[model samples]
Target: MTQGRSIRLFLVDGTPNGLLTAEIMNWTGHVLTGPRSKLSELVQRPECGRTGIYFLVGPDPDNSLRPLVYIGESDDVGTRLKQHNRPEDKGGKDFWEKVCLVTSKDQNLTKAHVKYLESLLIQNAGQVGRCKLINGTAHEYINLPESDRADMAFFMEQIRTVLPVLGLDFLRESFGNKAKAEPSDDAGVDSPRLYMQITKQGIQASAQEYEGEFIVMQGSTTRVDWVAQPGGYGALFAQLCEEGVLSEPEGKVRRFTKDFAFSSPSAAGAIVAGYNVNGRTTWKVDGSGITYGEWQDRQVSAAAAAAAAPE
Candidate 1:
């Protein structure tokens, strides 16, 4: 029989039998011991059936309850409490990490009751500088209707209070901001420079680029007249299909289903390569054998040479 926090020693029917014993210590640890009897024994006991939320507060060497942790709820408070003090389960270290179950007198420990108690603890835990409630049992209770469950609202509030402490800024940011109307003066600037449209039929891509201060058009459409470029330009066409840019078909092959549109030759090349196509080897500059990559390089070199020339 190990001593625990607050011992309760007594005799059974005038025979010196250790009916129950509990040890209570400040920060060291605590335990409770009793004979293995039927659940009826605990039910019949006057001190049994203790129900409610239990707080596991401990000193952080400074002997202050400022950094308490752990909150728990139990229908069978006494049994849960005993489990916390058992030596088998890491000496109750897991229970004390966030919450602990203590003896409660609430016999009819309904789901609502447990939720309400957990919520109260969560709310208070934040104020007391305790860790955030990592447990999900609190939220489970909130799903119940208030009419059916009295503790739903209480738990929600507690959850709200602790959410900030847990550094859940992403959730707060997402829910806090409301979408506003788009601002004016966003005409040409707002237009998508690239478009990848999916349809049920097939994929198509178009590109427009400035060449020597003149706009040149290049693209691939459903028209078979468009010359098929070599290398992996076909891959971009393939990607359009994979990306669902093409319309959904009942039973036809879904390959080459999507369409891509870009304003810059480089952008189109990038889109092709990014989607796993060899743009350099695939697309050709005009009817020449020069690849997209070779064309881009020549353009860059020409620009650099012109810039370095006198002026």
Candidate 2:
């Protein structure tokens, strides 16, 4: 079982959308985030003057479903941010609308430490493939001692945990670290496997629910043509197609090129069926024929019965 963690967040401007700072209890890292509009205020904070790694985040102009990210490190993040805030003609990026910076609260991070972190962050973001990276190439750093590397690795883990709480999930892995697109036999040890089939259309897809995410496994097939109403799933499918998650039409059907994680079962089902669908009722247990909704209800009822029973 996972242990619960306590995180402290302060809204620097007393507004949800304004500058904010986050700290995990007992952790030495400090995270500060704010919108590009708040750059003037953000740069004024002393934390921005320290050695740290920062992320510039925004929507991808071409792919609506994914974000574009730029990972960088600096001895003085405030100055670097200001330079990036300049006009595009002056070598600034126009796509990023928000910034998230990670610095050590203890002031122990140095130029070398941040550079090592930046490289790893860039590499990890690329491996996750949840965002489009604008960085040219990650620079290498091999000077850190083995002990420092171990410490930085722990710091990186904390960043991973806090970022999703702030609604940044590009570093979150959708498919568990296997390079294989198909689900392995041990894939469902922690979660139940579900399947969706449309015999009439020859559509057959497999999925699994894990940690609140619905993952559509690879090799799932779907209709090549869009039969549903415009927008919503149609828009999302187009974006997935653009991102190469789904392959191009090879006749009347297209296939999932990789396992993609969706926020809900309906979202995954919609992409598979090429339209809106009630995923709860459509996705059934791999062999039992019980709907996802039914299986969920059964689990809840079992837990309730156990709770109401003997001490």
Candidate 3:
């Protein structure tokens, strides 16, 4: 018996007969074999049957003192082990996908034992994303005898010992910590300065600015609908409202004071256009008319030309 070592047990399921083989690994990476026990032998023979728990220890590559997987009870432990080791199944991958099964040959397993097995699975499976529980009843060939309480208890205990060495405990702890640190709704709303609004019509937007050009605001909800340019335009409108030149009603068009004046012809032209207006086409810089789409193309071309130019 190896102290503080991890073991991997595979139980094969079969009708009327089953075999349980445990692969034990020690701390130094050595593998040891345990006595193979038959399901009938465990149930029929009192002395051998009383040996409900089996331990095999081997070296853990990741230096953890827990079994990678556990099986509670099954009618055919060998068959169940074969299913896990089969390459055709998604559960078959080795090393990357660590799995275990705890099962009993007794069909009439006690509810208490089933629950105990479930708890053990939950604790360890939370660590390995691939943990699963398969009902023996689903397989017609593997008929477990009813009311086998002793076998069920033995199976449950076997699973618990193997879980920690398999690194399942470490994973569960990591996941718990991650869940606690995740962001919440209150945290988001607390920073009003980082927020921006988007109109339902998908025209207006609000954004931050940098060096004479608009910088899209980080974490702005306005970007959900409106494009960058539209968002910037909405931000400009908001700035106007702040400056007292325009007043925006909750659900209506932005209104300018009767005495308010535009500093640029483009600004006046934009006002003349309808609600949800595309300002680039409505407004003009000089005598030339340009749409926002065209302006974006021009910017892309300028950037490309600068990149192509030699140092």
Candidate 4:
């Protein structure tokens, strides 16, 4: 098991959504986050003038599930942020609404150091595939001493740990890395934790609960087109296709290219079944003929009854 970690978060104006700073216990790096409207105040902070790597985060207008991110670095992040706050015609980046910057508390990052960090973060963000990156061209290489590169890589991991806690998840790695003791293929020893089916059309899928997401695993059989009634499910199917999460390899028969997360089990079911169906009722054990909702309720009731029994 992993050891517990301690982090301190400080709200500058005593508001939950306002400018905030975070630091892990015993870490030399500091994280600062705030809305674009608060950039002036953020720039006023002492560390804002330090060389650092920063992330500009905002929504992707075309897709609600994918965030829009712009990763950058600067010798003086404060000045760069000020420039981005200006009008687009004046060299500003209008797409971003929030900013998160990582700087050392000791103000040790140099220009080359931040550039290296910027490039690494950009590459990782692209591989994660959770967001739409807005960088014009990739910044690929930055020379650094071997020792410093190792230190910076460790620093990057700590930043990754803190970022999602602050609601900036564009830097998160892909879900494939989390799956263990199970391979995505159907012929494997470990099958999906749950199965949802549309038996008539021979449409079925393997899914599992993952980090609060109902993830339909890879190789799950799905429809190539949105064959369901025109409604929310249709919209979702179209979006999934547009995002390339679901694709047809042999034509008219879709396979999940990557694991996809649905807001709820029902949503996951609808996408896999190609219909506006009830997930709790549609998903079941292979031969149990019992609904997921019923199974869950039974387990809950049994646990309560067991707890109530006098020890």
Best by TM-score: 2
Model 1 residue 125 lDDT score: 43
By lDDT, the candidates rank as 2, 4, 1, 3
Better of 1 and 3 by TM-score: 1
> What's the TM for model 4?
0.85
- Please report how far candidate 2 places residue 20 from its true position, in Å: 1.2
The predicted structure with the larger TM-score, 2 or 3, is 2
* All candidates: TM-score: 0.28, 0.94, 0.23, 0.85
7-43: candidate 3 lDDT, tens digit per residue: 7544435432243334444211111122233323433
Q: Could you tally the backbone clashes for each prediction?
A: 36, 0, 40, 0
Name the candidate, 1 or 4, with the larger lDDT value: 4
- Give lDDT tens digits, candidate 2, residues 1-311: 46999999999989999999999999999999999999999999999999999999999877876899999999999999999998899998899999999999999999989989988888888888888999967888879999999888899989989998899998876666632453674453335889999888888898887657788888988878668889878988887887788999966678999878888989988888888999999999987999999999999999899999987
Which RMSD values do the candidates have, in order? 22.4, 2.2, 22.3, 3.7
Return whichever of 3 and 4 wins on TM-score. 4
Give the whole-model CA lDDT for all candidates, comma-separated. 0.39, 0.88, 0.35, 0.81
Per-residue lDDT, model 1, residue 295, is: 69
